[model samples]
Target: MPENMPGRINPEHITIVLNQPRYPENIGSGARAMRNMGFYNLIVVDPENFDLEKVEKLSTHAARDVVEKIQIFDNLQKALSPFNYVVGTTARLGGQRQVNSPSVMAEKLIPISKENNIAIVFGREDRGLSNEDIRLCHGLVNIPTADFSSLNLAQAVMVICYELFNAGTKKKHDFNPRLASCYELNGMYKDLKDVLIKISYINPENPDYWMNYIRKFFTRMNLRAREVGIIRGLIRQVNWYGQKMYKDGLDHKKNQEADL
Candidate 1:
């Protein structure tokens, strides 16, 4: 909430999410990592036997405040619902879950973090995120390790926090001045999908399949509000034109004869 530039990271804009963490000490350490990097918002989803006392003890004086402010949720989806940008952390990589290193991710995050509430999610200590859980994320972060890629939950949190914190606070330069909000992007995708379906561009059986790729393509563009509006307007016109020509009630033969 502090007066920052249009595209600078604010602590209030960042959230650290721990999904089903087994140990309270890890949560505490994650909190401690967050505090060290100037982040405070913490969300814990379906944790196991979490103890505030343990968190307080492990987090120590500086990070105790983060422990006190933890928000509990029944599921990952619900916890991340309010955030505009959600980044899932993973050690394993392949398929759709191919992830970027913390430092590389930090560079991409800094701009988005300014205008949106960003959630950086870490999975359980024992097992990492499930495929379904990872699917909900807009992006994924993977820490590159020398031997074993699997990092402890808190250590992964620390690395990401440090990278993001360092990049966010560094020298600021205006980039992509007017980025659209996730809400705006979501709306645009919906309208685009609907229009594409109407025009038979999106197959009825697998409409979402093509739309997903389109969404990713546009996401990489980091479209601004005005850019989104321009695309929306074009789609509306196309839809209107298609509807006018293809309406069921239209007597095409009769209309052609009358015109002749």
Candidate 2:
């Protein structure tokens, strides 16, 4: 591992996350690809088959260290809780799935990685990340392919890891400040959603649909921890004022009935 230079990426800050992977072989190969690219942190969320022997066999000796250090979580949000920035990988794009190419994602990540922990999330083999999974991501990356868009899980992992490795060696000095971790951002979103619903700013029946636009808007800002706290505080104040006004209206209605 090289020292963290001004324009170089620190591989230690980057994590490879596999979400709901079906096969042990793909997990092993994904670890191997991370090792090839000088990345070591690997997290598996809700894997279907996690056979250690098979995983080690496919990963081989070269990546045994990576295999040994793999962290398994029952869900994606908990697995990604510690990361400050998350870039999701998906072949399908439309609706809110605005994606950047691997190289572009790599470029964007390099600067962010300097001051934040990053997770490059790859979804399942059959279907990529679900809409809910995509909501957790700060950004998205799509590997360009021919007409046959489907890629083997390991192959997709390797492609993304390769780009990050390649980008790390280049000299592009763009400084991005530290951003809030997924945990803090998710907390802020939860509170914001509740407040929005209380004010009828978003439809209570389907708040997530409206919240998606808010998510993108805030994601673009790359809010820091303090900024998130500030937003949450504002939300609390709004909630308080709304309740106070509602109480006052009820009191006025009761007094008018008494006068009658």
Pick the TM-score winner: 2
Give candidate 2 misplaced runs (Cα > 4 Å): 1-6, 168-172
| Worst window of 10 by summed lDDT in candidate 1 | 1-10
Please identify model 1 stretches exceeding 4 Å from their true place. 1-9, 48-51, 75-78, 81-84, 96-98, 130-138, 168-172, 176-178, 229-244, 248-260
The digit string of per-residue lDDT tens for model 2 on 162-242 reads 989887544546568889999999999999999999998999999998999999999999999999999999999999999
Taking the tens digit of each residue's C-alpha lDDT, what string does model 1 give over 1-260? 23363334667888999999999989898899899999999999998978988988889999877988999999887787666677888877886555788888888887676567888998888788887676567788888889867788889889988888777444564443546655666678889999988878889788877977787687667677789899999989998888888774477777887999
- Full-model lDDT, candidate 2: 0.91
TM-score of candidate 2 versus the correct structure, residues matched by position: 0.94
Model 2: colliding residue pairs: none
Task: Tell me how candidate 1 scores on lDDT.
Answer: 0.81
For each candidate in turn, the TM-score is 0.75, 0.94
Task: Give the TM-score comparing model 1 with the true structure, all chains together.
Answer: 0.75
